[model samples]
Target: MSTEKIKAELRTEFGKGAARRIRREHKIPAVVYGHGNEPIHLTLPGHDTMMAIKHGGANALLELDIDGDAQLALTKQVQVDPVRRVLEHVDFVAVKRGEKVTVDVPVVTVGDAAPETLVVTENATVQVEAEATHIPEQFEISVEGAEAGTQFLASQIELPSGTTLLTDAETLVVNVTAAPTAEALEAELEEAEAEAGIEKDEPEAASDEAAEDGDSE
Candidate 1:
């Protein structure tokens, strides 16, 4: 993966109030730590950082320009405000070109399965180790025309060049099964309703005596 260039302003203030102040100015407070180096607190442009992360996929590699000195960093964690939907803080790990980094790559399925087949993605993401510059954004598996009873395992996934799979090879990632029939669906619905103590629709109000007479007849 190619690194995105972003500017970082050295931060001297530390506290929730300082963080709020930084956000109020449309900036994000972040820290970079790794490789036995002291964590460096800095402020990043909110819009640029957000765009970089949005476009860079899960593991956004960034080339931070910290006061003219360039440092390669990998996005480790991001904290966002649940209600405001704004970035609160970010954490990055210092890395270098050619260095191997472990990251979880999202497993995506391209193409549709066979008609009347249900495709279940057991593993949404798989862990892998690859060079910092060549990290894959995601893994796309084709389920085109896959039939029922088909199972795809992690070992069967094709990894990119220079990437090493860290997840167990035997792990089941995708499973294809026959779609439930109408009768099966109705039975499940009835069972769920029974469990929930929901009463099914009944016949128009009929007296117990009349009902018993009708049954007898």
Candidate 2:
């Protein structure tokens, strides 16, 4: 990952009203805290920040130009409006170049497993320690032609240069299993329905015959 430069301004106001005001101006309310220093409140350009983070992957390393002074920061938390889909708030931790940071990087699987096999990702992300500016976007594990019962553990992942795995070595990350056939699926569904006391409807031939006889009379 590369450091992205974004312009930021000091935020003097506080409270929900102030945050709303900042958003109305197409800016984002954020705070930077780290290294045992006082938290610095800031307002960042909404569109620029969004683009920078989007391209930077999960944990974006940014060089915030606050009033002409540059500070390297890493994205720690982000809050967005669920309905409006707009950024509501962001939190950053100040970091210096060459500093190592612990972060959870996404685990991605490449290629498909063997035919008629089901692929399940048990742990989608694994914790790693790496340089702040050189953090990897994701870790990819190849599952091509993998047989059933084959399991990939965190220890099996190939780490990037200068990256250390923090997750447990024995933790299961991906598992390949045989896919259930249609008959097997139906049987399981029936078993579930029986356990739930759901009786399947059946045709009542005797009752229908009695109704026919009464109608004839």
What lDDT would each prediction earn against the true structure?
0.93, 0.94
Estimate the TM-score for candidate 2: 0.90
lDDT tens per residue, model 1, 1-217: 6678999999999999999999999999999999998999999999999989888888999999999999998998999899988889999999988899999999989899999999999999999999998989899889999999999999999998999999999999999999999999999999999999999766556567678899999
Candidate 1 TM-score versus the reference:
0.91
Q: Per-candidate TM vs. native?
A: 0.91, 0.90
Top candidate when judged by TM-score against the true structure: 1
Lowest-sum lDDT 10-residue window in model 1: 200-209
Candidate 2: list runs displaced more than 4 Å.
191-200, 203-217
Window of ten residues with lowest summed lDDT in model 2 = 201-210
